[model samples]
Target: MRFEVLILGSSSATPIYGRHPTAQLININEQLYLLDCGEGTQVQLIKYGIRSNRIKHIFISHLHGDHYLGLIGLISSMHLVGRKEELHIYGPPALQEIIDLHFLHSQTVLRYPLLFHPTQDQTGESILENEHILVSSFPLDHRIACTGFRFDEKKRMPTIDRTKTEAIGIPTAYLPLIKRGNDYTASDGTVYRWQELTLPPPIPRSYAYCSDTVMTERYLPFIQGVDLLYHEATFLHDMLNRAVETFHTTARQAGQIATKVQARKLLIGHYSARYKDLKPLLEESKSIFPNTDLALEGNWYNV
Candidate 1:
């Protein structure tokens, strides 16, 4: 299964240093999920060659303008493009009202169905699940009600050894059961072991997205052991006090979180406008968590 995150924009409250706002496109098994629609997200989608129509689910972390200012525009564009599929939005309860108010004032009616799923504050709950993937939300420490998302690929069935099965004279009709780890009994009363006919499935991979939040341990368990973790680093350690006051995180703090959670790799972004050069932030983060990488726009990080 193919799983990767495409960074669309990576900036904090304001866009600076050539960085846009916060947005990401997560592609899991060819299905696209939009995470946080910050300003100019539509333009970034176009620039990155990601088809907007492919995105059926949008996740908003908070009500902050920098985190979700581009949502209405993107939805409007989808309607203009004649998209007929249902659009599922997962966010705070107020998000539905905000979208409805915008459409009411603009006299714009979407041609497709709009479904909203609100995340429960202060809770880590499963939001959606299918055969291929599962999505869950956990509360984050921020100025307002905010949440982080975890996307996990489901465990796959083992592959059947076609040559071994054929040589053993197993019927083709029993291949599906063998792949599911089931033993087959022929009419002659011969039992075929599943272990001898199939190979073990690969380990499932997961990715977590933590938007603007203050340093806290509350969300650690939800993101533990993820293959890739994207955490907001709005400032450097020098502005620790400012980060606390604004309910944001520093690069060093982000590294600490990634380390504590035992994440395979950390991708840090949501840079403050004050940072014209992000080398210092990266260096500071790497000093603590050597596996950290700066979340650069247009880059794809495989999970």
Candidate 2:
């Protein structure tokens, strides 16, 4: 199973010449999960050759226009394309009202079932779970009610050693038990231990998405030890005062958070439009956390 994050847009509230608003797509196994749907996100998805239909769940961090303005268009497009699969949307309470108003005014009936899960910014809890993965949301410091998400892949079952099983003449019907780390007892009282026929499962992988947050360490516990962390770095060190005033994070601040959390790799984005070049931001972040990278649009990072 592979987990990857594709950067769709990286700019902050204002749009730039080549950059769009904030958006990211997390591909876990074969399912697509969208982080934030910024303006022109659908176009970016199409440009990157990502089939929007594959995205079953969408997570919105806040109610900012730059973070969620593209949602209505994306949902409308899905209906236009005749999507019949049920879609699950997770976001703050305001999101439900926004979508309801849009659909009510347009009188557009959705062709597929839509499930809305409203998130309260005060609580940190597991919001979604499946057999293969789990998703949790934690509060973040921002101007508005906001949260960050963590995606954890469930531990896999131990692999059966075919050679050992064949040599032992174990029945194939008992292979499931062996993979589950269970021991089998034969009719003659011979016991077959699972350890002798199976190998340990690989370590599970995890990724965290923190968007539009200020310099706050409260999220460290939730994001600690993530395989890959995508955090917003809207400004450079020189603009730390402005970052604080606007309740946004500087590049160095983001790096510090990543370091404190002991993340394996850090990707920084949601850049301020004033920056014509992002090399300074990238260098600033890498200075504190050596494993930091600039979140460029259309770039894919494997977790």
Q: Which window of ten consecutive residues has the lowest lDDT sum in model 1?
A: 178-187
Model 2 gets an lDDT of 0.92
Residues 1-303, candidate 1: write the lDDT tens digits: 899999999999888877999999999889999999999999999999988989999999999999899999999999999999999999999999999999999999899999999987688999989888999999999999999999999999998988888888898998998888789887789888998899888899999999989998788999999989999998999999999999999999989999999999999999998988889989989999999999999999999
Clashes of each: 0, 0
Give the clashing residue pairs of candidate 1, or none: none
lDDT value, residue 51 of candidate 2:
88
- What are the per-model C-alpha RMSD values against the true structure? 1.2, 1.3
Q: Candidate 2: count the clashes.
A: 0
Instruction: Give the poorly placed runs of model 2, Cα more than 4 Å off.
Output: 186-189
Q: Residue by residue across 53-129, what tens digits does model 2's lDDT show?
A: 88999999999999999999999999999999999999998899999999999999999998999987787899999
Candidate 2 has which clashing residue pairs, if any? Answer: none
Q: Can you tell me which runs of candidate 1 are displaced by over 4 Å?
A: 186-188
Q: Against the true structure, candidate 1 has what lDDT?
A: 0.93
CA lDDT, every prediction?
Answer: 0.93, 0.92
* TM-score of every candidate: 0.97, 0.97
